[model samples]
Target: MSNLNLSLAMGDYDRTRPIYDGRVKIDGVDPVCMLLSPEEMFFRAFRHQAFDISELSLSSYSISVARGEPHYVAVPIFLSRAFRHTSIYIRTDKGISTPADLRGRRIGIAEYQLSANVWVRGILKDEYGLGAEDIVWVRGGMNTAGRPEKIKVDLPPNVKVEEAPQGATLNAMLAAGEIDGFIGPRAPLCYDEEHPHVGRLFTDSIGAAEDYFRRTAIFPIMHVLGVRRRLADEHPWLPGALLKAFTRSKAMSDAALADTSATKVTMPFVEDNLRRARNLMGNDIWSYGVDQNRKVLETFLGYHYEQGLSPRKVDVNELFHPATLESFSL
Candidate 1:
């Protein structure tokens, strides 16, 4: 049979490089892969169904599923995961030395329903007893003038969220101290330029992330591989094929990074960082597949429902294709 031709949109991470370069190939498919930014990829994918396969926001995907209007069927091959301790940045002058200090303050966010914000909010509620009603949220683009949440959000009546002032952005407002803190996947450029007043709430983000992992053991997942629902229904075998290929691609990236001769990534202390991560997270720190990451998925799903992103709590099994739930035994 002729191979399927599909468009795949994803970030150009080391783990996905092999597929991008064709060093790793997807079986039974000829992929037209384009490395795209999350903003472009998710906007196009969710708004227009622009790609056959794409990396999709976990929160947005859950919202779609819960609304009974799902356009994408996910695989367990997670494309992005991170510890979200570093997502929160606060004005040092706001008396916000601790997470609990965020209560009753105005917080700026690019989108109230972003996956990173969802994870950070969950951490705050679980660790510091804060909830949606505790703070006023300002929503706008991080840099541009206007941005909208890709999915609809039915927030609790008590949660206060307002649009940014006309012609303003969250990044600009944050720099001017118009907001007490900012929470999103990307830090404001002003913060990056070492602005005196803007600082991460967690001064020692690495240490804080380590502590979070020790307590929760969750490497918060940000993005999931999504296949168009119609395509998946037409070809029941496609999801499994895609997952196998991505898993192989990630394994190749892992093996390359673990090699001590020279370095796979252009960074200092590659070996030391790898060793540290392994020591903290075990050998398979960035693992893929359903069974191996059930706890992580379950936790994120809980937060999705709690934060009102998902109308009802989504189940881990409902998040991925049946073929991806398990693999044949060796």
Candidate 2:
């Protein structure tokens, strides 16, 4: 039988590199893969259903599922995960020293539905007693102007979100103190350039994240691998095939990271950082699959619904393909 051909789009991360380079192969499939930035990949995926398989934002995916209009059904393979403590940047001059101080302040966000922003808001609500309605959200591009949310959202009446001033970027608004803070997956360029007043709300983000993990054991998931719903329905085995391939690809990356002869990544102190992460989280810190990540998924779903991204709470089981949820064991 001829292998099924499909288009796959995702970020160029270590865990996915093996699949791109042919080190890993999906069973009975021939994939045409493209390495793309999240913004481009996600916008195209959610907006146009451009690829047969792609990485999708968890928050956006939840919203789609809750609305009963999901274009793609997710697999259990989590492609990106991060602690969003470092995602919040604030103007030090605004006297915003803690998460609580963000109340009543104008915060800039590229999109309210971003996974990182959702996680940050959830952390703020859960940890700092700040609700999503407490602050004003100013939405626009991070560095460009007039960026629209890839998916349209009709948030509840209580949530206050406004667009950035005409022709303004969140990066500029944040640097100029037009917005008290900014939260997204990537830091504003002004913050990266070491602008005197632009600093992280959680100055010691590592410490905060470490503490958060210790308490919650959630290294928040940002993106999930998704296959188009029609395709998944047509090929019942595709989701499981994709899951197995991604798992092996991630294992290859994990093995490379642990090799001491030479660092697989272009960073200093690979061994030390790996040891630190394992000590803090566990051996399989960046784990895939549904069973082991239920708590994390449930927490995010709760946050997603509470923040008005999802009309109703989306069950964790509804987030992934059933075939990808489990596997046979010997």
Candidate 3:
């Protein structure tokens, strides 16, 4: 019997209970600590070599794959929940009204290589003829930049990159007139309202993606759950266990959104959001199944190669094992 002590990382502890509770009951697999973010997961996975990392932020998959470390399972988590749309924030004083107005202005992003960053940039390039060379790019975190060699997209030449703490950095820079606009997931943009210095430019990522996709017919896969390769090779059952757990969690979250009980009274908006998430689980948007996930990774690799992100082309078939998808069957 495999004695697997798995450490899983997530964005929020409260939101991850579905997976935490479900995994504990799996035989031979033990879930240890549930981390709070991708950054923490990366640090712990690399910093502490004690416990084997079983699951972690999907964003970290690219890097983990590069290192050939733990077994990785590509599970779609936040993209289905969050990426249906994204928000762009700009100062009202700048008089920037549309995507076209963003030209020649400084844009703040949470990270340069984040999945959202890549999708947003791709949208700009494909729809508006904007490339990384068109705007000044300011990055929020140092580690947030993904492996350029793994996934390359063309960036504007005039881009200016910087690192700041996730929450306060963008607002501080906007208040000080350091940047003209900001692009990121909706939560950070929404949370910035507390600062009073920044204003929203656009409120929807889905709208932006829709406009872009209408023209391009291509949708970008943002984030995915990554498991280490080593652990996966040792214990094949883990990947299926993870997929089953996440699927259950997704269903529970959906049911919770539909419930009228007082416990769910505060989360009415989440119901519609959950339904949208369920719809996104379709073949086009969600890729929990193995073949579907491989296609997504291959698509990214192709984009990265065409955009000059990687030097020698990588075979998508080699990056992840085929069995990673069998978890959905469990």
Candidate 4:
């Protein structure tokens, strides 16, 4: 049998990729293409990169881009996690209570293109009656050293925008009263007694999603895996084998979770997390078998269009290949 080549999309999160990699080895599948971001997936798929999705009308690969297109061979395989944009945080001493209080205040974000920053800005515009012009915007770098791209948005004329160095530095700035509020992911804001200065404005992944859905009726598809559609079609048995491997790996993850001992966090914890993820996400993670996934795609497409990130509309159908449920029924 010829080896199968696959590509998976993953983020900075520690668990997802490690778990998938272990499963891939156990299942004996070979990965050929692997890009990290949903944005990159969209652009690469459009450009027909090494393993382009656009070239294959029927192949078994996973394509995670914004929600309006269909994949002939790929399937919407996972919910992954509910990623939220800014956890609007204020210093405890600032006494800012609500989103409304943030007007004219300074806000720090990781970067402009980062999904979290984009979603946060969208929420501020659609929900809080604040546009980009209403606050002082500060752009910070990522975890490692490098400057982020300058973001341009349609804000009111009064808002002043600037850039900073990093999230940790931004956190320091917040502590020093350099910024009034910080808009970033929830993980960054989870501080304890040692760093008690920050207070959460709200934990609103669902809220931001709801607002985004109300306007576009779609959820956002961030990180996704992609495969060269043509290759999978040539090897008809490839898709089923790949899906089966993932499913078995998922099952292994379950067994692993059940065996976890309190004294030591074994592979079982990872398995347990995978099992729970499967239960919570259902076929969304392995099969992409939900209408909600489509909604997310549509919403993301609209967002890109409105933001001027892309000049042309991306039809989901054109981006990925088609596959029946039975293709990933395992």
Best-matching candidate per lDDT: 2
* Candidate 2 local lDDT, 164-238, one digit each (tens): 888999999888878898989998999889999999888798999999999989999999999999999999999
* Model 1 regions more than 4 Å off: none
lDDT of 3 by residue, 1-330 (tens): 556777666554333566666632544666775645555454455445333543443333554454444345454443232332355677667778777888888887765655556556655675568776677767653223321222223443445555454554654576666778777654453344555546665656566655654554444555555556667777776656665566666656545556645446465566566566455444234334545455455656654444434444456554545554343223
Compared with the true structure, what per-residue lDDT tens digits does model 4 show for residues 117-206?
555655667667776567777766433334444223333345466867544466567767777777754334334334666766765644
lDDT agreement of model 2 with the native: 0.94
TM-score of every candidate: 0.99, 0.99, 0.72, 0.59
> 2 or 3, which is superior by TM-score?
2
TM-score between candidate 3 and the true structure: 0.72
Determine which window of 10 residues in candidate 2 has minimal summed lDDT: 172-181
Displacement of residue 198 (Cα, Å) in model 2 is 0.2
lDDT at position 187, candidate 3: 43
lDDT (Cα, 0-100) at 241 in candidate 2: 96
Q: Which regions of candidate 4 deviate over 4 angstroms?
A: 4-28, 31-75, 83-86, 142-145, 149-161, 165-168, 189-194, 203-221, 228-292, 323-330
Give the range of the ten consecutive residues with the poorest summed lDDT in model 3: 142-151
**Per-prediction CA RMSD (Å):** 0.8, 0.7, 5.3, 7.5
* Alpha-carbon runs more than 4 Å astray in model 3: 13-15, 22-24, 46-51, 54-60, 63-81, 140-168, 186-191, 194-197, 204-221, 261-265, 269-287, 292-299, 302-309, 312-319, 326-330
